[model samples]
Target chain A: MDKLTTVEGRAYPFGMKNVDTDIVIPAHWLKTISRSGLGQGAFEVLRKQPGNVFDDPAYAGSPILIAGDNFGCGSSREHAAWALADLGIKVVIAPSFSDIFSGNAFKNGILTVVLPQDAVDRLMEVAKTDPIHVDLEAQSVTTPFQDRFHFEIDPFRKQCLLGGLDEIGLTLGEADVIDSYEARQAQERPWIVPSAAPAVA
Target chain B: MVKPRTLYEKIWDAHVVERRPDGTCLIYIDRHLVHEVTSPQAFEGLRLAGRKVRRPDLTLAVPDHNLPTTPRRDAAGNRIPISDPQSAQQLAALERNAPEFGVRLIGDADPEQGIVHVVGPEQGFTLPGTTLVCGDSHTSSHGALGALAFGIGTSEVEHVLATQTLLLKQSKTMAVVVDGELAPGVTPKDVALAICGAIGTAGGTGHVMEYRGSVFRDMSIEGRLTVANMSIEAGARSGLFAPDDKTLAYLKGRPMAPAGADWDAAVAYWKTLVTDDGATFDKTVVIDAADIVPTVTWGTSPEDVVPITGVVPDPGSFEDASKQDAVRKSLDYMGLTAGQRMQDVAIEHIFIGSCTNSRIEDLRAAAALLKGRHVASGIKHAMVVPGSGLVKAQAEAEGLDRIFLDAGFEWREPGCSACLGMNPDKVPAGERCASTSNRNFMGRQGPGARTHLVSPAMAAAAAITGRLTDVRELMTTQKGMVA
Candidate 1:
């Protein structure tokens, strides 16, 4: 998959904390190994209610989600990230996100932006009306009315997402460095050779 | 200047290799336990890259999911067919992969087997002052013995398997000290939930907590596990209790445990992992055990809690703008009214099992409550699922299953059932339940199913009342007068 250079879309305001992965994508929907058919199950319980956010036509196909503090609070299930991406949620603006969920979202190319609760409240208000522009390279979210909000991301994760590389890709990118280190370590610590070769098979 | 060092810091520094510029560390994984649900992809990553497990000696795999608890009856004899085909395939994959990579595996039929987290500590694979990683979030359960344990994603799993070290940012440390003794009938589950209530779910953010105090010292190893298991609910990296004589006793002669001189050496080293006198912490929060009442989650989050005798909190009581909105939505979805007495609230079902409280001790407590008693006729489903096969066998041998079955509870096989509806065990949509699981997050039990987190004894009381009633009140009534 190619890296997402820019994320531009409307934001849905879900001002609630502890939005667990189970709620994002229920485990029953995880019967399959494929990534497809996930959007159908994205927030199925939430969508069951009449006039819920996902069901409301006003916020249909919004690519941004403005969430309250402690979003994505439970489970390390990557399916949550997959479901959000499949549903076109490009940026999640929350006061905070669970560490596991944030890591998973980063790996799956979803931008989890941490804003202060006050900033989140403002975005929640603004998302009710206008689209938001998220420029990954610039690391900012801009309102259609021309207000800009800057955020920070781990440079390593930013590089990975921009390059569309996973952990393997990150390691492979430094393959030469790793190989050279290994060659040097072989001379310095020959006892490490037996273990290293055993794992290379 | 005073240098602040908490038990968490003591453990972290003991395990640290070298700090990097970015604040993350290349921490060595002393133990890596994997289960069926989270290992397949990591194995696939390894296959794609042509790499074997970096430190097979430190890695262990176990089969818990899709392994039936019951012995399936065939014409020949009783046989459990790995009853679910997909799980069978995954188990077979592990069987094929583990040996090929020189990793040890505890198969389903192995007598030393149970849930991966359960068996790890039981077999002494997890120890104090070590960093442990698993692909499951509840890996934090191992922290009860003062180990630094956390869950990682599949990619990270692959990273650890390939390198035996993970690049992780160090977390801030906090101390949660509990003074005084727990009242009678209150279990570790109650104490854990009460702490969650006091801390408000996100209180432990960005921190790793070391549980201290006299109360923790008196708690059994099982009780300490219960307390540490739910640290994630409070949003901490993990929770820990310094390994003591109790920990050494539990690990004394278990399979895979260090033997003879090594065992003594390991314990001596573990004793030094404790926080030294005059150590300081980044944050400190103290709780009076006497003030902790049996508590349960009244709303979507673990922090949405109240004492057993308290009423549902009105949204008007919350000052946070977002909390009010959330309480409103949760009340609307739960069909609950503000200021409703928690004791009077009726429930449609009761669930007593999960990694949170599915050990033998929890089962025994629930069975004692239901002895010679029947569940209320209105209570539709009162179910008990064991945490693992070993737990089921232990309970059945003690006739705990009989107590549950006679009380109108459906005793089902274990595999994280009803904990979050991962399998066929689930409450129907819109039904309310008193659950013994750690999480009571929205839709955690099932779609639209309201789950009130309670201790096993309280869940038993709810089973008898068909409503959320205080176990203390039930005991009073059982003494022939309603308190």
Candidate 2:
């Protein structure tokens, strides 16, 4: 994951509400083991249509996306987030997001900014012409026309995104704490682990 | 005085190993169910980073999504190779990674191998008052047993494998209350679809939904599993029904359930897995059970639903233009006309299997409906894949397989067949199917394939009528017979 501070670029002003993960990247594209090269499949269905925002040359490689309510509302496939990042979308501004998709996006180093629908509507307007900017440190999205929208983000996620912290590595640092917890659980709940687990697992 | 906590709060408190000042919690995962499609990248990441699984005993891996539902062996019983090259590569990857990583791999031919969600609880790997996770979205299905289960992305999958814990945040709780009696012809799947429509797609975002009221309390464990399986469709991180006698009875004699003295101790803890009286919830949705009818999704999104007796709604009926436009796009993709009678909508195919409705009870219900009837001539394909090999065996033992097979339905091997486009069992383009699986998302069944989300009985009725017909129309007064 790359350290993300500010994402400033022309955004694909797609304001389609309830745009699910299947619409972001269809199930067929999920057969790959690798995460890269999925940009070709991002919004494959929508991109096939004439004059779709993703296919328009004016917004190619845009680093920000302004979307509508309930974006990324389906499958738990991180491929949806990977495809967005591979397509150069660093920030997605929506009124709300599905809980799992928001988490997946954060893990993939993509910023999901939840703004009021009015603010999102404003960004969608400005994105059609001017570039929009998002700052992690400030927790704000701003347009070139002096329209500034403050956002709320979890402090822990903010730190991870700004520093590109590896979550597993941080948790592994708490090995002692985890071990003691397991030890306590073993005493309290003997059946927690399969007692006769001499098998493969 | 201390504030009373809901079942969700109790589970969260029990699982938190450590809580950070930013409200983040390192919650220990008691169970992890793994499947092929979402885990290959996670395993590859572990290999690249030289990290080993922290507790392989707590993890169970099964090859479900990428493996074909076709026969796995020849007449001589030699294992057959997966025909699709891509799916074969993915299945082969899991086969190698699981044993190499010290995690159990339910082999492709293992009788226990099934949909990860279905196999987890059946094996008693999922328990009450525990935290469970899987890479697939329907992992919440295990919450039917009163666990704090939710789906995760591959990144979180690697996180759990490496640390046995996830960096999680506490979620608000919502209570979906349903009172009164369900109509005779209505089913649990109908109740779930009705809830989706009531809540809209994103209604449960940022919250853990707790199913409450008389309906859920009276539902069978399998019925509760079917309801909780669609929690993701409502945008909830998890949905759960409190563990009761029904949950304990369902787990009592299962292979992985605790034995002897451990059983008493486990049941004691499970009994504590309930909401406190007067416990406060962040949100509440009240659905009268009598209001629920035989329901089916009409458009691409799960929330785009109507009763089986209703007609396809016109996009112009929506007050919001964006929502109207979304409906219009969905109708355009689904190839449905506005105001058309839902029963008049025809289906060329029917699938009665998924984590949502692939248990023995679901199979029996479909078999009961198809006992003497046949698939309509207009239907091109009809298949009933059980949730697990054990379920298949149980069905065959009870002669349900005979009924399904005689009705022109393919009695296939157990796996997530045709529920997704990953495997070879896909509905062809421009065709429509009445599927017992969740998610009517565009192309979820196949490229440009239209799907109507329905119950097993409704799917069987569609198989008989070759269109979306209410099961009530074919159902009779017999206890088990749907006709």
Candidate 3:
């Protein structure tokens, strides 16, 4: 994951708020443990309607989604992110995403871009015609029409996503800290460290 | 930099195994709780990979979703067929799966059996200063006991089962302090709803909340559980209440809890989990509990709440244009006008049971309301479920079931019925119901169903009036225990 100053990609704008995880991916699709092939299952209900948004040729294969406020406000289902990532949605721009959904998105390497409602409204309007460029390094989304918007991301998360690091990567990065802490704990809370031989592997 | 500050900071620091250039950490899960709906796939994954549960002792399983609400025995004490096949099968799967994995299962018919959320605390499984994970969102309910309890996905569930740990990112910390006293009639449901309304649903984003206030201090363990249970709705991963005597009393002598000599040791461990004085937090919000009114949600989201007497909000009042469509949709589906007073609105159904409000206390409160009078005509009402077989049996022995039935309400078997539309007890589409369940999101009950969250007593009043009515009025009209 290289630092992305700007990501110019096709846009998929969904209209409305509180677009819950159930709507993102239905419970029926949860029968499998594998995260693969979930993209097809994403928004299956919406895709069922005639002239559905996700199926629109204009937004097809788009990796960016501009959405309304209060997006993703139901259950804490991580499948929502899995489906989005599987469908090539690398960035989700909304007035605000549900906290659980945002955490899930971040872990799965989907950039949850939060802008003001007005900004989101404008983006939704602009998304109909052209690709949007998101620069993680600059913390901004820019358009061909010269529209520019700035948003904030946790500096640490930005570093992780830019470097394509997952939780395992994060842990190893702080190996020195963990090792030192363990050593200190061994001295202070010796009882916590079992005196018996380590249990069977 | 200086050591991370705040309880969330300390917790995150303690759990972190490493941090990648990306922001997530490899955090260890101290405890894992599982249920039927989310476990099947994880079990399948293990079967496919020929793997075993890594630390069976740390994992616990329970059946709540598919358990029959009906009594398990008849007058002659014989087993009976469950009224709902789906629930029966779901419980059967849990019963079969738990034994296979060598994990404890509190079966539907087991006295220890109950809603996973309720049983965890009641059995003393939830401990302070631990990272607890469940496959259900309401896992946040456990945080009332001071643990960092949160939900996980099936893959994460399998990950925890295989390694007793979960890969995760840390969350920010939010502190909510409520001052002043609650009004006489206000309940924990109202307090939680008030918080949700004030916070606008997403205010607690990227944070685990520590509830600190006089109101929280005075609240019972049950009340704290109700408040913490809805933390996810406010977009917080968990809500914590500092453990006190109430918590200890609740956990004492439970079957799974440490016995005799170990009890003191366990208490000593729990005492050390609290935050020290002068701890700092990332954000803090303060509210006066006296300002809160008995609350009910007017729309699908938990954020769409107001004082009980207040009317549905006009869509124009919403600043975000995006919310307008949802307001209109919810109003259309609920058959409500923008200015319609919630108290003046008529309701067709009242559901008085769910993991959120189903307990001995909730049942007693509703039963007190229906002691003598019958439910209003045109109102279909029921206390269709409880958390466990023991709860149902105890309710019957105490004649609470008879009181409910006498009031023209159906007394049915226990399950997560009508809460999430996972079974047969769903409200019909387009019907308005006063429910005691947690989520009120659009179509959460069923296709096009309208739901309003309320306390059990409030739900009972609605049942008796065929409309949204306050419980205080009825409580004043009657006497004896209201729990």
Candidate 4:
């Protein structure tokens, strides 16, 4: 994962509410093991429509997406987040997000900013012709039109994103403490943490 | 005085390995359920990182989502080969990866093969006072047994595989209490749907809901499973009910459950998992079970539901303009008009299986209604898919298969068929289906296929009438005709 500080680019102004994971990447695209090439299948259904914003070259490779409320509203498939990342969407501004989807996005180094619906609407309007900027360090989103909207993020997640620290890395960072805890837990409740015998063949 | 602890807090506290200053914690996972669709990338991630599973014995892999539900035996009762290339590849991937990683893989031909959610509880891997995770959203189904279970993404899946733990943030707790007794003919499915209707799809966002009160206490393990399975549909990652005698009875003698003195100790610990009398919650919702009716979803989202006797809602009824627009889109996509009675709506197909309602109790409920009846002549296709090979065998042993087959419903093998159309069992485009599965999202069953979410009994009734008929009304009408 790459360290994410600021995402500045033209955003796709779809602004569709309750856009579920199914619409993000259909089940058919989930067959592949590789996470690459999902960008081609990202929004395959919506992109097929003539003059759809996803297909318009004007916003191609946009680093941000302006969406409506309840974005990523279905399925726990991480393919939704993979598709968005593959399509170069680094930040998604919506009024709200499904918890599972937000967690998925954060793990993939994508920023999900929850702003008021009015702020989201303004961003959607500005994204039609102008680029928008999101500064994770300052916790604000600003457009060239002098429009600025503040947001909040969990300090832990913000640090992880800025540090490019995945869960494994974070766990390894606390190696000494985890080692001691496991040693104590083994002595306290040996039955709970069973011996790691080889799985049945 | 010390504050009372909710069930969520009790279980969460038990699993926390370390709590950080930023409120994040490292939670130990007791079990990891894996399936074909979601595990491929995760295994690839593990291989790329050159990491081996920290606890291979704690992980179980099964092929369900992409397996063909069609029976794989010939007329001679010999095993036939899988014909679908995509399904074969997904199954082959699991078979190859599981052995190399030292994880147990339940292949398509294995007797234990079933949907991960169904198999977890049935095999006693989903124990009370434990934490479980899977890449599929319906993992909350195991929370019925008092586990802190929820779905995770592939990245988190890989993390669990490598470390046997996850970096988790604590969620707020909400208590949903259903008091009073349920009306006749209304099942837990109705209660779940009604709750979704009461609270919009995003009602429980960022919270874990603890279902309590008399209704939950009296509910059978199967009924509790049905209700907990839909917590994700209401935007909650997980739903839980404290384990009781029913849960203990369900787990006893299972393949993986603790036995003898261990069982006694496990039960004692589970009993202590209840919410304290004076516990407080971030949000509290009370629903009267008597007020709930046989309910079904009328539109795309789970929240777009109505009572069986009610009519489709008009978009104008919504106060929010965005919500109104959503309703319009849903109505247009579902091919329904406002003010139209749901009973008058016709359906072309019926699917009676999913993680939501594919248990022995669900099968028996549907079978009891269809024993002496036949499917309507106007219906195009109807199928009954069991949740697992064990469930299918149990149903056959109980002669429930005969009732379904005798009523002109196809008896299919165990897999997630017709639920999301990942396999060949799909409702054709533009066709309407009365389904017992959870989601009613557009293109969920198949592209452009409309779905009306219902209970098993409601689906059986719809099959008999070729429309959305209330099961209670049909039962009364049949009794009157017989008299």
Report the Cα lDDT for residue B100, model 4.
Answer: 94
Highest-scoring model, DockQ: 2
TM-score, candidate 1, chain B alone: 0.93
Give TM-score values for chain A, per-prediction: 0.84, 0.96, 0.84, 0.89
Fnat per candidate: 0.26, 0.68, 0.17, 0.39
Best by the TM-score measure: 2
- Model 3 lDDT per residue over B1-483, tens place: 454355556556666665657676667566688888777767766777676786577677876655555666788967676665655555566678778988777655566667888877766677665678987788888888777898876656776776666666677788989988988778888888888888867778778999998999898887888899989888887888877787788877765566565667667766655556777778888989879877888987888897877889999888756578778877776778989888887788888877788777778878877788777787855554765555677888999998988888887766677787666667777888899888887667766678999888788878877788877777777553322
Chain B TM-score for candidate 2 = 0.98
* Model 1 DockQ class: acceptable
Off by over 4 Å in 2: A196-201, B477-483
Assess each model's interface with DockQ, reporting 2 decimals per model. 0.27, 0.64, 0.20, 0.48
Residue A150 of model 3 has an lDDT of 95
What local lDDT score does residue B82 receive in model 1, on the 0 to 100 scale?
58
* Model 3, C-alpha of B325: deviation from truth (Å): 4.0
Indicate the residue-level lDDT of B101 in model 4.
Answer: 98
Off by over 4 Å in 4: A48-51, A179-201, B73-81, B479-483
Alpha carbon lDDT at B257, candidate 3: 60
The per-residue C-alpha lDDT of model 3 at residue A149 equals 95
Assess candidate 2 and give its lDDT: 0.91
Tens-place lDDT per residue, model 1, B412-449, is: 76666677765556778889999998888777777778
DockQ of 1: 0.27
Give one digit per residue, the lDDT tens place, for model 1 in A41-98: 9988778778777877888899898887778777777778778889888789998988
Residue A108, model 1: Cα distance from true site in angstroms: 2.0
Global fold similarity of model 3 (TM-score)? 0.85
Candidate 2 local lDDT, A49-127, one digit each (tens): 8999998899999999888899999899999999999998899999988888999999999999999999888888898
